[model samples]
Target chain A: MSHLHSLKRHLVARYGAIIAITVLLLEGLCMFAIRSYYVNTIEQVLSNRVQLTADYYQKYVPGVTPLARAQKLLSSVDKDEVALVEVLDLQGQPVLDSDGFIADYRHTTPEVSAALNGQQHAWVGKSPLTGEKILAVAAPLCRDESRDTVGVLRYSVSLEQTFRVIQRLYIYCLLVGLIVIALVLALCYSLACRILLPIEDLTIAAKRLGAGAHDVRVRQRSQDELGQLAATFNYMSSQLDAAERAKNEFLSSISHELRTPLTSIKGWSETLFSGKLVDKPNQTQLGLEIICEETDRMIGLVEDLLDYSRLQVGHITLSLETVEINDLVTEVYQQLTIRLSERHIGLTLDLQQQLPLVEADDDRLKQVLLILLDNALKFTPPDGLISIRTRFEQDIVITVADTGPGIAPEDLPFIKNKFYKGNSKLPGSGLGLSIAQNIVQLHKGRLEIASPATGGTTVDICLPQSTPWTAGTYNWTSKANSTRQNLS
Target chain B: MAKVLVLDDEIRIRGFIVVNLESNGFEVVEAASGEEALRIAHTQPDIQIALLDIMLPGIDGIEVCRELRQSYPAMGIIMLTAKEQEQDKVSGLEAGADDYVVKPFSPNELIARVNALLRRVTLVEQVSSSSEELICDPFVLCVSEYKLYKGEKSIAMTPTELAVMEVLLKRSGKAVSRDELLDAVWGPDYFGDPKIVDVNIRRIRRKIEDDPSRPFYIETVWGHGYRWHGESLA
Candidate 1:
C-alpha cells in the first residue's frame, strides 16, 4: 500500500495537473470574449447617440452659440443613456459641458480634433475632470448651407459598469473552472486506483508465492490488460504449485530409490567388512557382484537426473552422425532379447529393408529405443508378446508395441512428465521416457506414446530423413533456450 | 534354530537378508509378495518371526500385519519402513507390529531387535498354557484361544492389545512402571518409541471400559504408569 503513494502522487502531478491547467486556459479565453462583447455594445451605443446629436445640429437646429446649443440639446443627450455631453468650437476646445459647466472641461484630444475635420471618432481614457474611465465619441457640427464643420458634439458613457460586469463573469468562470478541475481530478484518481489496485494485489500475491503459499490468487476485476495480467498470474501460480508438488514427489521417490541401493550396498559392505566370509570365497564373490550391480543402478539414476537438468537448460549436445536405422534397431533388439527370453516374454521384429540413412546421435537414439523397450519389458507379463516394427516414409518411423495392460486414459497424457510412475511398483527412476522424448526432439524427431483399449501400449518414434546437424538447427544458446524453456 | 520369514520384492535385498539371517544361525523363509508371504506362513506354523517391507505391490505391509496378528497371535512381526514413512511407523504399530526397523539399518541393529521381539513372543506362548481361564468379574481372558470375554460377550483385540491386557491383568492392583511394561510386553531390546505402551493402553481401555475417557478397569497412575483396578472399581 505504501508503494502506491508515489504512484498516486505521479498521477496527480501528471494527469490531474494537465486537466486542471487545460480547464483554466479555456476559462481565460471565454472571459476575454465576454468582456469584449460587453464593452463593444457600450461603445456602439455611445457613438450612435453622439453622432445623431451632431447630425441634428448640421441639418435643422441652427446654433445661436455653441454653449446655448449644448444646453438646449442636452435633452437629446438622454442623461440615462450617456454620462456627459459637450459641444466644442472649431478650436477643438469644449465650449459647453453637459455637467452645467463650460470651459471647465480640461483637454483637447485627437477625438475632438478629428471631429473638427468632419470625421467621427471615439476613444476611451481617464476623464480629465474625474479621472474615471470612460468611452468618448465626437462628431463635427456644420452650417446647413455651407456644409462645413463649426463645432464638435462629444458624448461619453463611463466604462465602469461594463468593467464590473466583466469582473463578475471572471469570478463565475473561475468557479466553473474549479468545479471542472475537481471533476477531472476525481476521475483521474479513480482511474489510477482501478489500475494500481490489481497491480498491488498481484504484488502481494507474488510475495506470498515467493514465501511458498501455493494457493494464493487474486480476483479478476476488469476486461482490460490488467485483467489479462491477473489471469496470467493465476496460471503462473498454478503451474508453480504443480511443479512444487512434482518436486516433492520426486524427492520422496528418489530417496526411496537411492535407499534401495544403499540398503544393498550398506548391508553387503557391513557383512564383508565384518570378515564373515573368511572361509568362503564363493559367497564373497556373490556379494561383490551384487555390490557392483547396485552401484551401477545408482549411477544410472544419477545420470538420469543430470540428463533431465541438461535437457531443461538445453545444454545436452548431440554428436550427430549418419546411422542405419535397421542396424540400430537390430542392436537394441539383440541387447534386450536375452532379458525378454529369460522372463519368457516372446518378441518379434518387423523391419523395412534398405532404410535411409538419417543424421542423428547414435547413442541418444539408442537410449530412446532402450527406454521404450525397457517400458515394454516392465509392463508385459510372462508369455506376453512384444513387437518392434520400422517403416520408411518421408520420415523413418519406429514403433515398439507390448501386450501388457495398456495405460489408463488419465495417465497417458502425463506419461512424458518426469517421475510419473503411475501406480506401477516396478523399480526405475521414472525419468527414462521423458529424457528419451527430449533427446528425440533435439534430433528433429518426436515420440508418440499411445495405449489402445485392446490391451496394449505402443510408442512410435519418427525422425526426419535429413536435417543437417548445424549449429543453427540445435541452438546451443543462452537467450533462445531460456525462451524455449519458458514456452515449454 | 529360530525360524524367520523375510519378505521383500527386491531379489538382491531378500538374498542379502537371507544370507545374513542364515549366517546368524536362524533358518529363513523368503517370499517376494504379500500373498506369497501369507501362503508361506500358512504352510509353516514353525516360523515364529516375520519381517515385512511396507511398500509391496498388492497388499501393503500394514494390512498384512493386521491379517497376521488376527490368526497368528504369537508371531513377532517387525515392519521395515523407509525413512520418509514416519507416519507409516506409527500406523504399523497400530496394525499390531511389535517393532520396526528403518531402511539402510545395520544388520546388528536389526538382529538385536529381532532377538528382543522373540523373547516377548515366546513368553506369550509359554504363559498361555499356564492358565485355562483368568477371570475378574465381567472380564475373562481366554488364554489358549487368544481371546477375552466381557460376561460371555467376546470382543475383538489385536495381538499387541491382548498382550498389554494380559500384563495389566496379571499385575492387577500393582502400579507397574512404563519401563517394566515395555520390557515385559515389547521385550527389553525393543528398539522403538516407548509411546507404543500408551497407544496400546488407550486401545485396551476402549475395549474393556464402558467409558474409556474415565477408565475404571485400567487406571493411569499419573507420570508413573498404569494399574488395573480389577473388582475394586466394580
Candidate 2:
C-alpha cells in the first residue's frame, strides 16, 4: 500500500502533465496511421476493379453499341462477384445496369454524378437497397484513344470486407501500442524513482541533522549524480559529527574548569562566613578576595558558554530596545579604555550627529562590539595602531581595524567558526568571534571581514538604517515610532 | 516541652533543626536513619512530631512516616523533600504524611510548623470535654475551659486545636484555606509549610474521633484544601 502511495507521489512529482500529453500524442499518431492505411487500401482495390471492367469492355465488344457493350461487360464482371457495375448517362439515368441496378444504386450520390461527367472518383457511403456500408468507385469512359466522353462506368463494392480488415488491423495496432506505452511508462517511472530516491534520502538525512542527529548520512552508492550528492551529503554529515564532538569536549572542559574554581569559592566563602577560618584573619581575607576573582572568572566563562549554546540551539531570544547607537558604542569604548590605552590602540569615532536611534538589543550589541574590540586589541601588537570607525553608509556601519599580521587566505574563511583560534598567539576560548557572528545574525545584521593589502584584518558591522518604526510609520518621523523602530 | 523526633542524614542540618527546636522549647530526639527513627518512634511513642527526610539511607522517610502513622496515629508526620515539585508533595501527602517541608528549609520555619502542629493537636484533644450545647461529631466541647469530651471521657487538646474548632463551628460547613488559619492562629508573619493545616487537621481528628480515616466533622476537599461539615456534627 505504501509502495503504491509512493509511486503515485512519484508520478505526480516527476511525470505529471508530460505523461498525459505524450499518451494523447501517441493516440493521435496511431489514429492517423490506421485511417491512412484503410483509405489507401480501399482506393487501390476500387481502381483495380474499375480497370478490369474497362479492359473487359474493350476486349469483348470494342466497336459495338455502347449500351449492349456496357451490359455485356457488367454481366461478365458481376458474374465474378467483384462489384455491381453500371453505366449511367449525364441526365441522371442509368443506361446499362448489371443485375438491373440491384436496388443498391443511388442516383443522388456524388460518385454517380461525378462518373457521368467523365471524372474519376470514389467514396464510401451506405447502400440504399441493402442498407450496408459500401465503397463506390466511378471512372469516365472514352472510346479507343479519343478524349471525348461517352457513358460512365460506375462500380461499387460492399465496404464490409474492407471494414473487417481495417477493424482487425486497428485492434492489433491498439494492442501493440498499448503494450509499448505501458513499457515506456514503466521504464519512465523506474528511471524517475531511481533519480528521486537518493534526493528523498538526502532530505530525510537533512531533517535528521536538523533534529540533532549529527551522524545522519545518505548512503546511496550508485555512480550517478544522485550518488555524488549522497557522497557529498555523507561528507557533510561527517564534518558535522566531528564539529559536534569537539563542541561537546569544549563544553566538558569548560564545565570542569569553571566548576573547580566555583567549588573552591563557594566552599571557602561559606567557611569564612561561618567563622571556621576566624583564627587566620589575613588568610581568610585573601581567600575572600580570591573567591571574588574566581567568581568573576566563572561568570565570564558561563556567559561565553551560554552564548555558544544559544547559537547552537537556535534559541537566542532577542528583546530589542531603542537606543542611541553612538551612545552604546561610546560606552563600550569607555569601559575598555584602560586596555585600549595600555595597548596604545587609537579609537576613531565618526558619528553622524542627531542620528536616528537604532532598534536593537543594546546589551547583545555591546557584547558583539566588545568581542570585536578585544579581538582587535589581542591581534595588534603594543604600540601598533587600532582604529574603530563608525559611519552611516546606506546603513549604520561600524568597522574595527587593527595593524597586525594579516590572516592567511585559508584561515580567513573559518575565522568566525567556534574554537577556531587563528595565528594571534593569544590564549582565548575561540568562542568570541563565533558569538559575535551569532549575535549580529540575531539582529538581522551582517559582519564582513576584509584583510588590507599590506597587513591586518578589518571587521565591519552593518545594520539597516531604514526600518519600520510602527505599523505605518517610518523611522525618521514620529518619535514614538522611532522608539519602536529602534527596538527592532 | 513536646517531644520531637528529627530524622536527617546531614549532621549540620540536624544540628540546626535540634538547636532551633530546643531553643523554641521543644525536646528534639535526633536519628540519622529510618531504622533509628523507627527505634525512637517505638521507644518514645508519644513523640508529637516526626520530621523525616525523604532521602534517608535505609528504609526511606515515606516508609518511616507510614510506620509511625500506623503505630501511633496521633503522631504528626511531616516528610522532608529536597525539591518543591508537585509530584513529590502529592506523593508525600498521599503516603500518610500530615505535612511536608522542602529543603533547604529555614530552621525557624520548621520549628514554627512543629509548634503549630503540636498546639493544634493538643487543642483538639482538650476540646472533648463536657458541654453538650456545642455538638461536634463524637466529641463535645466545654465552652468554659475550651475542653473536649468524647463519649463521656475527657480528651486533651492544644489551644490552637480549640481555636480551629471554634473557627470551624463559627463558620460551619465552610471550607477554609491554610492562609486563613495562619492569619488567625500563627499570625500573618507565619512563613512555613501550608501543609501545617493538614497536619493540624489530622491531629485534631485523631484525638476526638474513633476513626480518623472517615473523618465526620472535618472533611477533605481534595485539591481545594479542607472543609468542615455541620451536618456531620452530632
Which candidate should be chosen as best, given lDDT against the real structure?
1
Q: Write down the C-alpha DockQ for each prediction.
A: 0.57, 0.01
lDDT tens digits, residue span A69-108, model 2: 6666666764666676777665545676777653333466
* Cα lDDT, all candidates: 0.83, 0.71
Q: What TM-score does chain B get in every candidate?
A: 0.86, 0.67
Name the lDDT of candidate 1: 0.83
TM-score of chain A of each: 0.85, 0.53
The true-versus-predicted C-alpha distance at residue A256 of model 1, in Å, is 1.5
Q: What is the C-alpha RMSD, rounded to one decimal, of candidate 1?
A: 5.9
Strongest candidate by DockQ: 1
Docking class of 1: medium
Q: CA shift at A374, candidate 1, in angstroms?
A: 1.6
Per-residue accuracy of model 1 over A148-259 as CA lDDT, tens digit each: 8878888877888778888998999999899988888888889888989999999999999999899988899998999999999999999998999999889989999999
Q: What stretches of model 1 exceed 4 Å from their correct place? A: A1-3, A77-168, A211-213, A268-289, A307-317, A466-488, B1-6, B18-31, B35-50, B66-77, B90-98, B118-234
lDDT of 2 at A469: 48
